[model samples]
Target: MDVRTLEYFVAAVECGGFTKAAARLHVTQPTLSEAIRRLERECDAPLFHRVGRGVVLSEAGAVLLTYARRVLKDMEDARQSMIALRGFQGGRVTVSAPPALSIEPLARIVGNFRRAYPDVTVVMLPTEDGALAAAAVANAASEVGLTDRPVSADLRAHPIGSNEIVVVLPPGNALSGKGPVSLEQLAGVPFISSAVGTRARNLLDESKERGIALQTAVETPHREAVIPLILEGVGAAFLPWTVSREAESRGAVVLPLLPRVAYDLLIVHRDQPLTAAAEAFVATALGSSPVGGD
Candidate 1:
C-alpha cells in the first residue's frame, strides 16, 4: 500500500516468512504480518498463500513483488538524495577503482578529497570486476566511481584520465635493457597477468583479437603482488604507469609499450539524476589537479 508495507512484504518474502522477516527487521511478527495483510487488502487480491512450511507468492503476488521492490528502491534513493542535499560535513563516500589506481591515484584523490571535505568518510574498494558499474546499477554504493571503464549502459561514463601500461621485465632477462617493450618483443616470454578489471585483461583480449599466442606464468588481482614476480623474472607484465614510475625511481627500468597501449581511466555514475553530495564529489574529482596537470 505504501513504502513501509512494500518493504515489510518484500522482507517477509526474501526472509522466507513473517517470523524470519520480523527477526531480521527487528519487529514483531504480527506487526509485519499485519502490514502484508494490509498490502494484500489494498490490492484486493491474495498476494501469498501458506504452502505447508512457508509462504508462496500467488500469481498476483508475483506481479506485485516487482513493483514493490521498485517502490522501495525509489523510497530509499529519495532519502539518500535528501541526505546529500543536507550538506552535512560528515558523510560517507564509497569508491571503487582498479587495483593499481586504488593504491596510488585513488589514494591521492581520497587524500585531497578528505582535506577539502574533511568530515566526509571515504571508502575505497579495489576489484577485478566492473565494480563501479555494478555498484551504481545496484544502488549499493556512492554515486561516484573511478574505474577503467563503465561497461554498464545504465551508468554515465566520462573518460577522465589515462594510465600508462608499462612492460615489466625481470632482472637479467635478455630484453631487460630494451628502452621500450612491445607485444612482439614479449612474444615468447611468459607473462604475469592481472586477474580482472585490469588493462591486463584488455591486453589479453587484444592478443586474442590479433590471434597472438600468449602464456601467463602468474596471475594476481593486485599489482603489488604482480610486481614481485617480475622482480623474480617469472615473466613480464603490464601495469599502471604509476607502478612503473615507482619502480623506475627505485632503479627498475620501465619502458613504454611500443604500440602505445594505454589504460583509459573513466569516472562513472548512475544514469539517473545525482545527489548533491555526489555532484560535489564529481566536481572535485573532475576539477582537482591531483595529477599535476596544473
Candidate 2:
C-alpha cells in the first residue's frame, strides 16, 4: 500500500523472518507484523506462508515481490536523480555482465567512469551469460548490461566493441607452435568448454550443426576454471583474445582461429530514459577502445 510497507515486505522475504526483518529495518516486530497484515488485506491474499518459524512467499507474494523490487529500484533511481542535479556528486550504476566481458571492457569502463565520477558507486552483477544480463536490465535489477549477442525488442543495444575468440592449448602440446587453427583441424580434439547456452558454447553448437565434428572433454559452469583446466592439460578451450593472452603469459599456448570468431560487445539497457549515472556509464563504455584491437 505504501513504500515503507513494500520495503518491509521485501525485507521480510529476504531476511526469511519477521524478527530478522524488523531488526534490519530498526522497527519493532509488532509494527512490521501490522504493516504486513495491512498489505495482505490490501492485496486480498496472503503474501507469505508460515513454515517452521520461517517464511516462504505464497503465490501472490511471489508476484508482488517482482513489482515491489522494481518499484523500490525506481524510487531509488528517482532519489539519486535528484541528487545528481547537484553536479553528479553521488549515485550508483548497476551493471549485469557475463564473466568474459567483465574481464575486459567492463573493468576498463568502470575504471574510466570512476576517474570522472569518483563519488558514484559501481555495482557489478554477474550473470551466467548474455541472455541473463539482458534479463537483469529488462527486470530493473540492473541499470545496464554488457552482452555478446542481440537482446530482446524491449531493450536498446549500443555497440561498445567486440572480443576476438581464440583457441587455447596446454603447454607443449603437439599443436603448440601451430599457426592459426581451422575448424577441421580442431575436429576430434577435446575441448574445455563452458556450459551450454553461453555464447561461446552456442558458437560451438553452431559449428557442430554445420557438420564440423567437435568434442567437449569438459563442460563447466565456472568460466574461471576453464583456463586452469587447460593449463592442467585437460583439453583445449575457446577464450576471448584478451583472456587468452593472459593465459598465454601463464604458459597456455594461444592461437588465432583461422576463420576468426568474434563476439560483438553490446551495452544494453531499457528503451526508456536512464538515470544520469547510468547514462554516463554507458557513454564511458561506448568510448572505450575495441577489446582486442587495443
Candidate 3:
C-alpha cells in the first residue's frame, strides 16, 4: 500500500494498539484503524489480532513486520541517494570496529577524510561481539569493517596490520628478565582475562582450544585497564601488541606471548567491489590517500 499505511502499521505494532498509535501519530483513532485495515485488505492478511486488553501481531503480521522494516530502510536509502546526486552538503557512512582500535585511529582518519571531502559524514560504531563481518554483511553497517576476521566469504579483505598479545605483569613480579613467556608458562599465575563475550575472550578460548590453557584471574570488559594492574605486578593481562607497544615505550616491558600469537587488523568490504566511498576509506586506511603520499 502507500507509505502512510506502512508507517501506520509499523506504529501500531510499536504502540501496541490503534488508540495509542493514533495518539502518537497525532491522528484520530478511527483514521489510524482505517489505514491499517486498508493495508491488511490490500495484503489479504490481518496484521494484528486483539488480545485480552492489548493487540499483538498475528503470525502473518510478525512476518510482514520484518519486511516492513527493510522496505522503510530502503526508502530511506533511496532518499539519501537522491540527496547525494543533488551535490548534497553531507552524506552519512556507517563504520564499525572494536572499541580499542577505534579510539585512536578513527579520529585521525575522520579528520583526514573531512579535510579532503569536507562534506561526507561518518557514523562511527564500536562493535562488541568481535564479528564485524556479520554486521557488514547484514548492511546494518557499511561494507567496510575493521576487525580481526574477514566479514564474510562474500566480502573482500585487506590487512591494516597485525597486533601482538602481550602479558601485563604485576609490579615487581619475580618474573623479570624472563624472555618470551608462553601461555603454558603463565599456567599457575593469577591472571585477568578479557570478559567472556568479547572477541578477545573468544580469541583466548580458541587459543585454549589449540592446547594453550589460559590462567585468567580476573575477567574485564576493557582489557586495556588491565595494564595498570600489570605494572603494579598484581597479575598478568593480555592485550594487543599495539597496546603493549605504547606501554613498552612508556617503560612497561611487554613480553611477546610464546608461540607468537598475533591478530591481524583487517579492512573488509562486501565481497563485491566496494562502493566509491568505501573504497576510498580502505585506501586511506592502507596509507594511500587520494592526493598522493599518505
Q: Pick the candidate with the highest lDDT.
A: 2
lDDT of 3 by residue, 67-102 (tens): 676565456556656666676546655677776567
Q: Which prediction has more favorable TM-score, 2 or 3?
A: 2
Find the candidate with the highest TM-score and give its number: 2
- For model 3, the superposed segments whose C-alpha errors exceed 4 Å read 1-88, 104-107, 172-179, 197-199, 203-214, 222-224, 246-251, 271-276, 288-294
* Per-residue lDDT over 82-195 for candidate 2, one digit per residue giving the tens place of the 0 to 100 score: 978998888899999988878888999999999998999999999888889998888788889999878999899999877888888898878888888898888888888788
Error of 2 at 35 (Å): 2.3
Q: Model 2 off-target regions past 4 Å?
A: 16-20, 51-53, 204-213
lDDT of all predictions, in order shown? 0.69, 0.88, 0.66
TM-score against native, each model: 0.69, 0.88, 0.68
What lDDT score goes with residue 288 in model 1?
A: 54
| Model 3 residue 22 distance off true place after TM-score fit, in angstroms | 10
- For model 1, the stretches where C-alpha displacement exceeds 4 angstroms are 1-77, 80-87, 131-141, 150-154, 208-214, 219-224, 245-251, 290-294
What is the alpha-carbon lDDT of model 2 when measured against the actual structure?
Answer: 0.88
What TM-score does model 2 achieve against the real structure? 0.88
User: What does candidate 1 score in Cα RMSD to the true structure?
Assistant: 5.4
